[model samples]
Target: MITNFLHDNYKNITRVSILDAKKVFYPMKYVLEKRDILIDDDSALIILPFPEDIKYPSNTKMTDAGMLWDYKVEISINNQSALTENQLMRFLNKKVIVVFHHNDGKIIFGCNEMPLQYGYSEDNSVNPAAHCGYSVECRGNSYYSKVST
Candidate 1:
């Protein structure tokens, strides 16, 4: 179903590893540009789900590269109380599905599982919501080998 959604909506999606932080922003940037979503607010981060199958580069020292991990996601709007931790966690815990709807009533779903790793305030301060960023780490097994039809 997710695969169908992505195939019907988005043009294409590039899979990037979480360890590859340098390229991680590319998909985010692409989604923002295509959706015309403004990154000025924390809501932008909420629109997209965290990616899965994050592995370190071959040269990295970490041996357990294929293990699956969880992530914490936070979406800060103008008001910090707009969304509570429980609510945020629930949203992030939802199935990793992204459906891109076009004006023509056609939909394309991203054929990828976007799992959240973790979340918290960037400044380490608890206050009104300022920015929404995720603290994601790998979890479980890698799904990179799973093929799609």
Candidate 2:
């Protein structure tokens, strides 16, 4: 079975919408980072049935009995000359529903339920024109499905 769903479709995402507003379209050169964690699984081990006549080693089975569907996502921003540090501070701290849209599907996730915070880029000294650069982390249910384009 092919379980690597996110790997096969990450690039299809074309936009990200925060609630009903704040849409960030794709192909933006300023996207510093993007990632998704899918299929976080935990399984139980079961002893396998063995033949009496054959002297075979004991075998075990892996069961997807307690699989966890908790998904996580991270998005980083960079080089936003139009946004100021103060503005970014306000935006990053709010709780909002984030919608990721792809050519073949979409996923909506929650952020800031525990409060979202933004961090400065590692190399912050080079750009001094209030070039907006920050990172956001989000977590949500892992259940997602593709839709017709």
Candidate 3:
């Protein structure tokens, strides 16, 4: 049995409300879909799964206000399609909010107040046959919390 549920649909995240970051404002309340992580149950929010390489040894610095953190995530989207490429372009030089849903019902949120800045990097190929698409890197602050769902 094929496990790629989005192989046929091939959708991408074009909106922030896909995961509803508002509901997860606090640590206790949250949401997730681990069993069907890539399943776009809502027609309003068609999302695809991309592997994220979160830079380790996360650095936390002390600031005048309080503590501050810096994070970097490398997302590899493989080859979704040309249409997907167009949609992904909109993220460049933009503030992107990401809700990383874990298998054990936990979510790593790209800070709601200070969303991450996104841009493209290390594009594998331009040749249509071998084109893998952009390797997006999002850098900013983040917080972790348990998923309420």
Candidate 4:
């Protein structure tokens, strides 16, 4: 099971921190491999692989590879320039879901709700991963957007 593997392998190693609310961290190791899948203009369906050295809280258990609980994300984008000084700030108000996928399937991390955004910044630096050329897909949505760090 995922929990068992995480506990036995990454229980004591691997750490992540979000420097900015607009950005999501994608480990450097997977950056190159992730580039190809994310660069497509089409809404790409790709699995997010987690490093074996990362572990979830013991209390949080996964019945399958695609199930995760207690992780929540919110993303907001501004369609109008006058509403917010920074376009990325719009994402602050939107609900977001960080999905993790593996060989099995996709799992929603945090909350399973759709997020709201008023506008989106043309600036790619808003999302670090996207700055590196990775595209992000909203779960279950046909839209494909770029994430700029």
Could you tell me the TM-score of candidate 1?
A: 0.25
What alpha-carbon RMSD in Å does predicted model 1 have with respect to the real structure? 13.1
Best by TM-score: 3
Model 2 steric clash pairs = none
TM-score of each: 0.25, 0.40, 0.52, 0.24
Task: For model 3, state the Cα shift of residue 80 in Å.
Answer: 6.0
Give the least accurate 10-residue stretch of model 2, judged by summed lDDT: 40-49
Error of 2 at 40 (Å): 31
lDDT of 3: 0.44
Candidate with the larger TM-score of 2 and 4: 2
Candidate 1 local lDDT, 18-37, one digit each (tens): 22122123242233223321
What is the Cα-based TM-score of model 3? 0.52
RMSD of each: 13.1, 18.8, 9.5, 14.9
Candidate 3 residue 133 C-alpha distance from true site, Å: 2.4
**Candidate 4: where is the Cα deviation over 4 Å?**
1-69, 72-90, 110-149
lDDT of 4 by residue, 1-149 (tens): 11112323332323221122124333322322222112221221222223542233323334433223332222222223443334234333344433433433332232222221222234345575542222222222111112222
